[model samples]
Target: MIRTLIGALGGLVVALLILGVLATFGVWDSIGRVASILGGLVLGMVFGQLGIFIAVWRE
Candidate 1:
């Protein structure tokens, strides 16, 4: 469970980093601020679930 939590946190961090880079490049400008934020959250959730799955599978 701890490992899974760590994986999810790591995934969230990675997602935020990716979002930051895209925002820096003006990729989210057309989408607007709220939509961009929501998208990032959704992306983070997906990555987090993937991380959890990997952690559980490895064990």
Candidate 2:
């Protein structure tokens, strides 16, 4: 549980970093695209946590 929570926090930090880079480069400059990217980031984090939990459980 603690590992999953930490993973989530790390994912959020990574999302913010990616968003910062996009804004800095003037890339993907649309509300819908930004939303989509954010959605994907969240989804990726969820799947990543699931995978982590599975791995830890199997160990």
Candidate 3:
């Protein structure tokens, strides 16, 4: 559990660093619409996978 937490935090840090670089290049400014679309895509995938697993587990 602790390892999972540490790994997640490290991943977040790396993501932030990459975002910082993108922001410096002005990619952040144009990412508003893309961000929403990507977030929705990821959320859909995550929940969809969870729903699939639960359905299968119920069998």
TM-score of each: 0.49, 0.56, 0.54
Candidate 3 regions exceeding 4 Å error are: 1-25
State the C-alpha lDDT per candidate.
0.70, 0.79, 0.59
lDDT of 2 at 11: 82
Greater TM-score among 2 and 3 belongs to: 2
Write candidate 1's Cα lDDT for 1-59 as tens digits: 66666666776677667767777888865647755676678677767777777777898
The RMSD (Cα, Å) of candidate 2 is 3.9
In model 1, state the lDDT of residue 51: 74
Off by over 4 Å in 2: 28-31, 43-59
Which 10-residue span in candidate 2 carries the lowest summed lDDT?
Answer: 23-32
Q: Alpha carbon lDDT of residue 38, candidate 1?
A: 62
Q: Name the top TM-score candidate.
A: 2
Quality of model 2 by C-alpha lDDT:
0.79
Give the clashing pairs for model 1.
none
Decide which is better by lDDT, 1 or 2: 2
